[model samples]
Target: MLVHKRVVRLNEKPRIRYGPMLIRDQERIANLNYIYNCNDIEALWMLRMKRAPFARLVQTFRSRGLLQDSIHTSVEEQVAMFLHVVGHNQRLRVVHNTFRRSMETISRYFKQVLYVVGELKGEMFKSPTGRTPTKIRTSPRWYPYFKINNIL
Candidate 1:
């Protein structure tokens, strides 16, 4: 048996440039501060993960007075909570342990906020203009996988 050796290009240094940091505009900064200061863990989580849905949920909750007397958690906190949950997908107890809050509180707040998000997403998806056309005519063999996959 003959053995062959392979040569590798190991001397190529990657050209990397660190871009300058971008500062937020005054209005955007103010809005971010307001959201960060005013939202709760659940609210913040929904906002960060699904901005449009979160906004809709917050609006609905505000209109219904559901959040009027609730604790003064900032939108930023809510966003942070969402990121934490998404990053960990752990149990409620795990979330509570991580967030330093009781499981009951986390569950209650998360459910309420998520309910609103679900409703908003449903409504948005139900709109006729939001859907793709059922019949999309394409040339035969243009996408062979489409025929193979029975999608054509």
Candidate 2:
């Protein structure tokens, strides 16, 4: 009887070149500055908001303590990821590729940003008064079947 044997290596080490590397803070800052310097149209296409409005929104978030930079990522990148996910309805995998972040990190920050926005909902919205003008309210009823309050 003849038998064939297969050999396996037990002492092999995992590859380091295939592992992920941390993005430098300077690179992130430079990318963010370029985006911030873009024209209104370009900014709208990239972030789904005009440059001025986006800056104001970021400022508001910072002022309200709703967002901050993580040790590995900047506030601008986080905000951009959030907006990109929203504007394009992208999947987590796609977001990971665009932001160069792990799926878990992207998801965690996405949810955190959503939570912060929800927390600010009250401050962001104004209650509707549903009031009619005096002229319309005091006007003689042209049609008795129609009522302003009911219509509203």
Candidate with best lDDT: 2
The residue-by-residue lDDT of candidate 2 on 1-152, one tens digit each, is 12222223334565567544435445545666777798998888878989887877778888878898778766667778888899888898997876667899999888987887788889867887776656666667733333647486
Which portions of model 1 miss their true places by more than 4 Å?
A: 1-60, 63-69, 72-88, 124-152
TM-score of each: 0.38, 0.64
lDDT of 2 at 93: 94
89 Cα displacement, candidate 2 (Å): 1.4
**CA RMSD, predictions in order:** 18.3, 7.5
Clashing residue pairs, candidate 2? none
The superposed Cα distance between candidate 2 and the true structure at residue 78, in angstroms, equals 1.3
TM-score, model 2 to reference: 0.64
- Kindly give the number of clashing pairs for every candidate: 12, 0
